[model samples]
Target chain A: MSKQKTEHRKMLNATQGLKNVMGRHFLAIEQAYRDGKPTAWATSGSPVELLYAMDIQPILPENSATISAAQKYSRDFIEIAEAEGFSYDLCSYFKTNVGAVISNADLTKGGTGKPTFMLSTDVICDTHVNWFEVQAERLKVPHYTLDIPHVVSNTNNRQYNYFKKYIAEQLYSFLDFIQEVTGNEYNEERAKQVTQNSWDLSMVWQDIYELRKAVPCPMSTRDTFGGLFPLFTMPGLKEPIKLYKRMYREAKTRVDNGIGALEKEEFRLMFEGIPFWYNLKFFGMLERWNSIIVYEPYTYAFSKYMNPKVTKEMVLSQPIEAMSELMLSFWYIYDLKTRIKKFEETVREWKIDGVLLHENLSCRPNSCGLYDLKRHLMDDYDIPCLVISSDMNDPRKMNETQVINQIESFIEILRKRKKK
Target chain B: MQKIGIFDSGVETPEEIVMAAGFTPYRFFGDPTLQPDRANEHIPPTHCIWTRNLLEQAIKGLDENIVGIIGTHGCDRTNREFDIWIECLNLDFMFFLNSPRKRDNLALNFFINDLKELILRLEEVFNIEITPGKLKDAIIITNKIRKLLKDISDYRKKLVLKGSEFHELVKNAQYQDKNQVLENLEKKSEELKSRAPFSEKNIKKILLTGSEIDDTEFIKYLESLGFHIVIDDLGVGTKYFWNLVDENLEPIEALAKYHLTKPINSIKYPSYERFNVLQKLIEDYKVDGVINIAQKFCEPVLYDHPYLNKKFKELEIPYLFIEATYNRESYNQLSTRFSAFAEII
Candidate 1:
């Protein structure tokens, strides 16, 4: 076999193994659900754990919102949120949240059934904590929102305190609710066994993010990222964890050799703002221009770190420490200063020539405050910056041709600067 | 020398920023009420509802007193989408911010540094000091206005006020005259405080989050539901006041302090200290529940809501989701959803 193909096969094998391990974890959870043993959701900052806490089988609005945004139905759903008293300029993610909730009008998480409750956290994003407030209020469901303080340095003390407090409270509450709803006592024996599976599932899933080590990326960024998809849907399930192991070992080798596929020596562009959904072609076309979008700073990137705060103290009356993607994502520690520094450093590190700031139509967060950032890039780095226009999910809001033309102009500026 | 004037976006005139700088701070509103030329029409046609609204507002009157204009990235549609104008239309200067929307000194330092950079470029290109003293004066003057306004708003919210009329105060407060505005506010506060507090019994306090839902009908709908939207995450409401200057600092230093200290509205930039702004709004208003309104194709909110929703769930505070559309025909359905959300909590 050729050197590239050999690498690819190794990557695939690793990913396949991880998936297998995750499968076992899922099987355990599914079996518990089928047996009607008892299940509950308590949340930490991570979606992975939240899935377990939310009972794993229920259609979570958080999971649904992101998927719906990617599906482009987020806007329609967001409109429902706005009508229900949400705001236009608040946050696009929240809008998609409305979209996810409204779009999933009837979607359930697990094939078995919708979970009994939703679990949440205020540690990651404030808008969402409130967004869940609206959801719980509307659903009239008894849910839990664990308030995690801002982990400025990503400390375990902070997370442990929060997790222990909320987990303890939630356990008592869950104990009461379970008795009232199912007339079951606090089933410690069953809960521990189930919680371990959930932890095993996350440990395996973490392998997916670590799987980018294969040269030419043995598996595609698509395959690697895709392997973790089950984490959202099948939290506490075995497949996600099982699938990650194979992928992990292959990635470990790749990382050892310093042979990852993101084209390590290229000018890594930190893409800001929403992609034109109408022009989902934006990604393809931009990539075609020799412009590599390093990270878009969405939830996709938010899932790249592990929680430093989960110290078995139990913040939400459940095993939040062992799960949840938020704590798992390195980006949770990603602050604006860090990001700006990263943007600058990455440009230096990745040999970036220019940055394409898509000033999205509806997302004020990414789109807002460009003059300052743009000015800094130009003055400090002497680099060219381009601020293009488009919507996050809808293309109807922009003129595609004009955008292309502007991008072309930006490319020219970048090339001109690069020549110097 | 012709000087360039940069200002934040939205409805209110940037007269204060302009006037205090000792140079004409032109109102560079993207809204059509102040149309300069067809600079933006090429990037996005006039058909876009937001573009059209901006053009209409700009056309009404964007003061052409300044030689150059600076726009914040916060204004979404018109600020960063200026390549069309810079390339095709030809303006003297157009600078956009690459600011991070979070309360951290780094961002503030970046902004002050950028302002200096902008000044340097403007000086090199247009020969303008927006100077240390002038910038300082601008900051001080701007602070005065903010303090005065904040005081009046606080006074209006004081529980013991008799027949307190905040709407009247908000309307009159926008007037350029500080003394007159203060006088009116004081008188209003006295009248309101003299009377007993309005019964909080049925008045549903709401925290609204979304786009520029400055429409009268939108506000009215909430009011009809017996909800008084006390605060919002809207640009015109919660977002604009997110940054503050640090004490024990020079005006320019203070300006820089705002960058790192401001609450981030963008989900693109990671802010673990998220919801600082929203939480403040909730506490200040004694908000019962929250309403997060998302615009048709916004991305930040898509990322923003989960964090907010997560918090609300933990707090057990009910929040509603409302998505916005330009399709006015859908108003009835929207109203029904609004009523349903309000009724839940």
Candidate 2:
């Protein structure tokens, strides 16, 4: 057999704008650091709108970890953190950030500069609050943790109301903390506008996702991985809205032209965990087997709002309440039945033929239900499913050759099933 | 009485509520002896062995008397494991209580609301109403057990109880009927108070902290090495019986306040209080060193190690970190490490 190199497929044209978005984001943080502006390192799922309204520049170390992993610098950073008594069993993203922070790595290599304060929420996972606490202590910065209750099931009205009220109260406390830290007045109109902007951006993101349901998916997981970046890091800003609007148009154009991410989209796969950041080319390698990952809960999570009917009135008049909803709206935090239903719906809607479940060792919450999820989908739909075990950011755990073999076998199985 | 299996480390499960609902609150620590072959198929091997062992036990039908399971949102593993059990097992009753990580009034209120929801579910499923009066009675019984356990734990400061013996008592307390456990604990506490304290001049005092440690053998081994366990912050240890429920308050509200204000595990936020609590214990017990023992792949405790290490360093306290699976594959290595840690302290 002749040797063949994996081809790197180009992502959506609008993704070009992401470079500028990322540049401006890091630059703003740099300026904040240099100019001694009020800044806080916030978790990706935190209420960045509140931070933005308070004129506190929110730096996302999670996003920085992602950037470091993509740059193949996470391994060294992770080792540095591991040497600092952080167990290798912990989250790779967190370790990478800790490593970068400890080593004082440069911006290009994912060093999140010290901030005046730190903020995190346990809305997504239990790891967030503790992880941020570690950094806050290390950096000698005061940290605030927002306790957002998990929405196990939305059907329980009284229970959900309590959860909402609890979260709203926490958000109010969060505002007080920010004000106390920054000595800045709470700008109600700016908070409202920021919330509105995030909502509008999420709506456009939802539209972009809808366009992915096209027979030949206009956008692939590889693109959405990058596309979801600004949405996470700069959610309350207008930049994401502009970028996502352009992405919607580009994806719409692709769908209109019947252009898929691949030359031949033979199989559509749904990925169930975070992508392997160090080897994103693995997504491209799947194209060699005539497969395109059109759906991933991990990617869509940035745009998946549990409460879509959050009104403008609610956003304006009750900004904290609206922020509470946004914080509680993460899909992964919901119950198993609801998440399974959404998974099945996406499989049918996106025409997914196979599922790639990455049992990421670092993220217990995301990886825990995946085995059962795979079983349910396969049992119900008779679809092919393959589980890849590795860490999302830690390259040490991934065996490229073994993963290739597994993918080849899974692709063969999918091909045979399709032939039937 | 029938049993309601509790899957948390027992901090947020509120065994009193289970007793109020007319069931034994059987705290399910994954069997250390059992190999979780089936659970490995469901969750990856990277998951903590305690959760995997619990799932394996449930899958194998090892405990048929468990009428239901009360899983709490204490950690990510327990939270998701609750979801997994709901999907994979056919239980008569399953409740995932959303215990808050933060200790605030809102969390207290939310926890009360959640406990009430749990009470309603338990009532509907088991055909039993958990009246506040019944709950208050359960609190008294549990509070008595807590007092007895606290008395026994205090004796450890005097070296009156072996670490292994205390671990056994705590472990057995979660499995047996609350009334029976209370009886046993009362007798044990009396025996401990009457017994002569251990008088070893060279015994090194050590504080234990981290994940739910079910391995009594490990504790026994540590004690055998001439190190006295002064206090523990483990979920199955002090965190289980640290705080007394305010019997003066409403039953559910008291339960909520008790669990929230207790010495929280590594998963809870505002970890300074937890550290401070441990520090206070260290000072009170005159602990020579600290040993944080976490189950391999346990996230919460492992995440807290760096911070804990920093605190220990600042106080010029010697600290040793150990990550062990349920299986004992490295006893010799651990003994060597512990011996070295002991000598330095």
Candidate 3:
């Protein structure tokens, strides 16, 4: 087991290096997409394209937020927002967006320019619609929310009608607002092309994840997380497709060669929480400890991971579900329990000995029911579990000593089990 | 319609809530120093001890009488908690207050209005009518108690009564009848220390905040660590008691006054006056550390933790965010952090 673990670590490290190179490529693509000021309007899959049509630099608030919690941000922003009266805990991303972007009038210093508008593609949580709506009211900043369909039964009609009646018309209004703000005409053809491109990449990323299911996984979660950068930083585009294909090919070669990504693969760990910010070197934990963490929650969020085998015609037929199903849309159907069950299955199939759940304080989605997950892991698999409480990004919010203490104790528990 | 139970610590519980619904307003005023050793075994030591105490009371059936609980995002720890806890323990709960940022007066005004909206929302959720008459009656009950405590405090200053008399008077004010407030102060136990009169034991005149150092060991730890620990304003210290009104003023106005008069210590104290009062205490008593002990997820402090850190940093005074959980296992580390800090005091 130890030798196999070493092999897994070696494989994950190499895969990580490849992903880092791929990340650089994705950044280059983002650089191309960058306009003046690097200012981004944080759109909640609710109605993001308005900013794109408006020429407002689009930055994923979830990206900054997760990274911020990983960085250990100015404490949990959701708490601050909740105290400010948005009391619903239905969506953490919404709470965070409001906390970090809207309420944090000082956020301008962090960015090159002011985030003029926040768009929401209200698909996952209904609370998000109210959240973005209320923020727009409070800040008096224009907020555009495109109601995406919630996939309760994999049916699109109810979702499509809901989109038309409550969301699509509002989306059109948002585009008009963008036109007024940026003076850029809405380019329908370009938008459709990017949408199609993103839809294709989604399928591709999903396929890559499926291939990674092989024992001594030819790819590492670290690689998948890193390589999915384009999807997050610049989703619905060409660069991500190119990047995923390259990584897929690289991993396929390793599998074909019958060489492990690591010379030895021992314990497999499944990671939760927005990846650690400063110590993004979180992957390094497995590297140093002779283990491999095979899957990450957020990386699978990309087009390819969630919507694999997506055909161009399939996406063209239902553009909204094509893009939204996995991102904004899927969360409702798969829900928290489904995701956890899937994570548990993945861990068992990967033959994981332990799980390192980062109980990120700020990420409501990740934090919700973590204690419950810890209980489940113990009762079901009798697997040793360690939960590190942390903020995803804001470095100021990280409690180094507390976290280090938890890690030491958790490791001790698992190690003690081995000695027995 | 079911009545919603609105409970808060210290004098922060509004006087008008009962009047709005015409139900008995149940208060949960606990002794700040009423040691809770049992809870220490269950929760982490770095979390809010006050909230831990509350949870202890709740889980232990001490607060089973209350129908529901309303919490605020005053700290990150408290903010993220409650829901998980209540579900696990099976208590009905909801979040009703907004975060208060007092940098701007308009923001503050907006904040008060937000609270007003929260009160109404609570009414709607609980299915009760908040009549003006009930508010006025509730105000009277709270005001009468506040005045009595003020009188006890004044008497203690003049040597007309001992400080223990006042502690006894204030500690049981929520449950005891108003006539008892004066009687409790008058019939205080004679546990006076002659070697060091009440003045000599001036309690190092410090403001102590930590996750439920309600355990005497934590208090004894602070004392053994060298600084005298005085007011527990933030945790299970002074803020755990609810005030009774005078049975006089308008209910809403009385509610406003109760929130206003609550001795403020950063966690949504009615006004900035609490900050001023805290500064005055630090200046007058030659106080040392503003140790903020927050339970993990005591939402109020998590929101206020950064600001308090900033203020203490700017003042160049000793302030520690002793974010311990229910039961802290790291005494060596805490001892090292505090002993070094105690040297400055």
Candidate 4:
């Protein structure tokens, strides 16, 4: 009898599982919408455990916009938003999300569904507040904003303490808002469980990323970028945990089997900022050149949970403070020094051969520091870095051939450096 | 003595403290002539042109005289500019004041704490003690300047002053010494009030809003096109001068309250406050149209545009939105649009 094909026989088995996880996640959201359950449009760094505990489905427009851009369907939605006076230079995710909402485009059929209310945090980017404001206006729903101040100094600074206090207060207020909107009592147990689940998933996700540091890194940027959907969409759920477990196992196996993401693995690269979601196939093209992007700071930044010691008991005891710390761990909340330290650590650990920084047109907070970061990485760490100008979703802002040429030239330089 | 530079939008800078700290408080305005090539090298091209221009000015405009620069967190672009300047500039001191967007007890507490931190840092950096008496004296001088500015703006609404002249007065106030600015405004106000109220039969009164409007040429162009900018909600215009710190309260807390209660801008939340302010301006000025002069790639202003458009439509107000840069070449299209808007109203 022929030997049965094992599930992990193919390199893409874990990635395929991630896709299924995302599919089911979206289907559940769609089912929730169909069932007349109130859903919310939440910022990626917003306190989502509250929504999950309240049984309110949280749909992240950023994630959905990424999906739309990946599917090459964001242009029409963006144009619609522009027609409504949204600037093309604004965050493309905003344009795509607002455009999709105004046009009544079934984003879930494509990626997400219309939100009944909007909840956003002011932690990651100023764009989140403005984007959700426009979305709430367009959808004619109530909008809630959680102001999470950036920690300007070390974790122990007075500013950080005040920020924690402010965020905790806001988180409690947010819970009250959720309760009022959903007409449901606050579920302390459920919220704790959700936070605990988030902590579990974060550990597994970090474990998977740590596995990529192995010689001949086991995962590709494309796989990790695609795998981020479940984490972004359903972080406090079993689906993402299961998906991450599978990913971790596959990466571990790849390390043990001495298999690299690329056939020859000539160069290991670190990609900064968001990729051009419209053309993820470009990542696959890099493999042909024997270069693999083993490190993407955005994935690691988003997947990192603040405290590993967080237990269900701790979460139940102080859900607001717990949620505040969780949201505060968002990479954008860090000051320049801490942020730079994190980047340097990632580069050292991943043994990054070169850095490709995307000067994303739509994202200011993420892209604004690329030039400064590139300068530091080059001058201080002696790491070669390149800044590629592109948009997160808008194809018009990118020249495909030029991007390819830049990447090829970068890869050639990396190869020459390695030879030296 | 070397001058301490401050961005025009540094409303919470406690300029008096800087003055007491033995440095001249020089408010840096955007030079329309400065090329943003150097800034573009540091910041992304998609950032606000106004901010890029400011960075260019910081890099080249104040070469030797600036001892330190105090930046504020008015918007994302401003925050990034502060980061770049702190990292790149070889200055004696550079500080960023992270002001909260909301106006609440917590926000005020944060603002006061930040202000106190700024004071302590200034004392440490410059080796100058900031006493309450010195702060009070500085507040008095700044308040006089603000009062004069308010007079000039109020005169503009009453048709006693031309829009270009009012902008020039405000621009001078931004750059000149507080005493010198007050003297000029006092003299200009007397001359303007003595003259006959200027009126044209068909000219439209337009209320300008959005980011900074420092282009004197653009103001002249609008006036030439038979439009009077009766009022504005710009960061560097009326919004900068209309609010004054309370003298009775502790100076630091008063400054915090002043910033928290300042006219709403696009960066702040519950943006209805901005709409309310704009509506009041429109009504007070009896404006014929509203002109939103936004810098391209300015997220805050761009985000507020759609809602403002809807609000204007609901209120039956004619609205003209124009995206601009700090270049003269870009004004032709703006001039044409303004002229068309003028005709329509």
| Candidate maximizing DockQ | 2
Q: Write the per-residue lDDT of candidate 1 for residues A138-194, one digit (tens) a residue.
A: 456555554332222112343334434433444355446545654555455445655
Output the worst ten-in-a-row residue range by lDDT, candidate 3 chain A: A105-114
TM-score of model 1 (first chain only): 0.62
Give every candidate's TM-score on chain A: 0.62, 0.95, 0.69, 0.93
The candidate 4 chain B region of ten consecutive residues with least summed lDDT is: B7-16
How many pairs of residues in model 3 come into backbone collision? 112
Q: What TM-score results for chain B in every one of the models? A: 0.73, 0.96, 0.58, 0.95
lDDT of 2 by residue, A107-192 (tens): 89988888999998887777788888888877899999888776553236777788888988888888888788888889878877
Share of real interface contacts recovered by each model? 0.00, 0.77, 0.01, 0.48
lDDT of 3 by residue, A61-165 (tens): 555455445444434665666566443322354556556764452322121123456565434333344444545555566655543322221122433333333
By summed lDDT, the worst window of 10 consecutive residues in model 2 chain B runs over B324-333
TM-score: the better of candidates 1 and 4: 4
Best by TM-score: 2
What is the DockQ score, from 0 to 1, of model 1?
0.04
Q: How far off is residue A145 in model 1, in Å?
A: 2.9
Q: Please, what are the lDDT tens digits per residue for candidate 4 over residues A377-411?
A: 88998888988988889988998899899988988
Model 2 clashing residue pairs (backbone)? none
Q: In candidate 4, which residue pairs clash?
A: A107-A111, A107-A112, A108-A112
Cα lDDT of model 4 by residue, B36-97, tens digit: 89988888777777778878877765747788888877776566557777776787677777
Residue A332, model 4, lDDT: 50
- State the iRMSD of every prediction, in order shown: 13.3, 1.9, 12.7, 2.3
Worst 10 residues of 4 chain A by lDDT: A1-10
| TM (chain A), candidate 2 | 0.95
Sorted by TM-score (best first), the order is 2, 4, 3, 1
Q: What is candidate 3's DockQ? A: 0.03
